[model samples]
Target: MALQRVLAVDDEPFNLEIIEEILEDLDFELRTAASGPECLDMLEEFNPQVILLDVSMPKMNGYEVCRAIKSNPDTSHIVVMFVSARGSVEERMEGYSVGAEDYIVKPFGQGELTAKLLKLGHMLLEKDILEQQVEDATTTAFSAMATSSEMGQIVNYIENIANIDDVTTLAKALINCMSNFGLSCNIEFRINDEQFHHATSGMCSPIVLELFEILKSKGRLHEFTSRILVNFDYISVLVLNMPEGDSEKHGRIRDHICFIVSVTEQQLLAILTRNELCQQQQNLNGAIAMISSKFKGLMLLLDNNRKQNEAVFKGLQEQFEQRIPTMGLDEDQELFIYNKVDNAIQKSVAREEALIQVRAAFSEIESDLTALSNKVDEK
Candidate 1:
């Protein structure tokens, strides 16, 4: 929808008059309130997409009024921008703490207010789209992690998380735990810069993921009316409907959710560690196979070299014996030559013996590697 409807709440009539003059020619259908209480009284009748709330008003300050508006499920979705003279970081931060979406200091330009409202108007439209998408998600069919004692259910989850071998199962278990407490939640489990999300309304919507990014940094617990967000380091769970109008139940639910998310974070960490180890084991096994194959190739090369040496030396010795007497040497000279030739052949035989020993050493080392691989598997 266009940025048409707006309610400007300020005690000073002059300030309200200035807002009127600025917006007189603009497209905004503006209304003014003299006090915080009056602004709230007009909220339902005006039903504005935006509320330009004054920071300092008699009886009700902007923060308190904004808190009231935000705490109410009916008006929580309306965008609130604090209009105040003080635009310090501290002032803006205070506004945000009360769930104000934007701020405008005193003496803001017509262009500045218009631009900010337009920007927030676009935000509201986007929020509507996201909400619709969330509504459209398939509802999850899951058996709640049922138990009478909330602590007992948590204990069961702690025990069951270990058995959840994958991200999907872990997400489901967490969702089931939330369902047991009568809370509908969307959860994100992040590790190693990867995100795994689940919703009680089926797979997590992109909108829910967007919310995870937006509210995850707003401390451990962020509440906007009935919606509760419990954020931890690696896990964020957004409860869709925290029981409204029940302070005690709300407090208990928040505590339960906080603990559950904490536990889920630990479990997610463990799952990541296990996955990393399994991958490492797989890589190690591949490396071992390659090394073993190379070792066998080296052994084969050694055997081939030994055979070639034997063949070459045997051929030379046979030729030497056959051609020796043709030189017309004496029998004694021939004997001397025979002994020398025998000694030289002995050298080749000794080399072969040394090669056989090297092969035996390679075999021993290969066996050792195999044993080590087995031990790794056992461990």
Candidate 2:
């Protein structure tokens, strides 16, 4: 890895040289600027990790310089420390007010300044490592979900699961997945004056719910996700739900679980249509088999009235073509059809006397994804 870059900006040549000597032993790529303009120019090309700025410059002082650095999105996250002879409590407050992270007074020992810089550098390195881990984990999750058919189908409708028209089987599948991960969760979706609730195993604590409530009612706030962590565990949260808004990094965390929610009513409708189509196809298959069997003998028996029989058969064919459009099934409809077909299968396989046998098969495959969503929301 490249060495962490440090920038020291002061108008006085003597002060800049002294700072270079002080930090000579540290593992950093040190750069210096003799004036405020030179600092800004160097910032454009140097991209330092931290900047030590002098507040007593002749023209643009440290406060003004810090403001310029913080205002620019590219350099805002860079640590800025104000160096000056002013060490009073009021001066420290003023320095911080203008975006200075730390204030250092002149006539200080070289060891104290070097130690502080080392600590700050380590914190930045740690934050960078955490960000990389998060990116890696996100990539792994998407890859796993993409390849697993069962997980893929369920994840396909993840955003729409809450509003799906037929949620029974899909909900069951979601719950099963959560159980596999050892998470207990509940879902509470509200619209206008109405509220809907679903739970698998454990209910989220009141505090967690309240955090969500505040987020919803007050809109996005600073450090929103960090505030939520106070009430929920890091491993437990998969996605932190937010109201529809621009994506923002609300806070830093060791294990950050962030969600991006962008839902519309049209998407919900499409899922419902898909579900209906899956159910219809299943029904049509069964109906065709039964009708074909019942008519096989009758067709043979009508050999004598061939002309009349031919007309009747043509009419039936036309009716079937005119009514069924052959459009695809949506996710919600697919689940509904799958459930209806499955229930029919279970019924044919065994009577109420053998209910446990049929249910055992279902228990093997079905899961509860909403519970996972709830766990993520709780966090």
Regions of candidate 1 where Cα sits further than 4 Å from its true position = 1-148, 331-336
Q: Write the per-residue lDDT of candidate 2 for residues 218-245, one digit (tens) a residue.
A: 4322234323321121111222332223
Cα lDDT tens digits, model 1, 1-379, are 6577999999999999998988888778899899889988999988998999999988999999999999999999888999999999999999999999999989988899878988987887888788776665522211122223777888998999988879888888888998988888888887778877788988778888888988778788888888988888889999999978767567877888888888888888888788887787778788878888898898889789878888987898898789987989999999998898789779888988988898788789878877877777765
lDDT of residue 193 for candidate 2 = 47
Q: Find the 10 residues in a row with the least total lDDT in model 1.
A: 138-147
Query: Which regions of candidate 2 are displaced past 4 Å?
Result: 1-3, 137-379
- Winner by TM-score: 1
Model 1 Cα displacement at 296 (Å)?
0.5
Model 1: number of backbone collisions: 0
Model 1 residue 14 CA deviation in Å: 71
Cα lDDT of all candidates, in order? 0.85, 0.60
Question: If scored against the real structure, what TM-score would every candidate get?
Answer: 0.57, 0.39
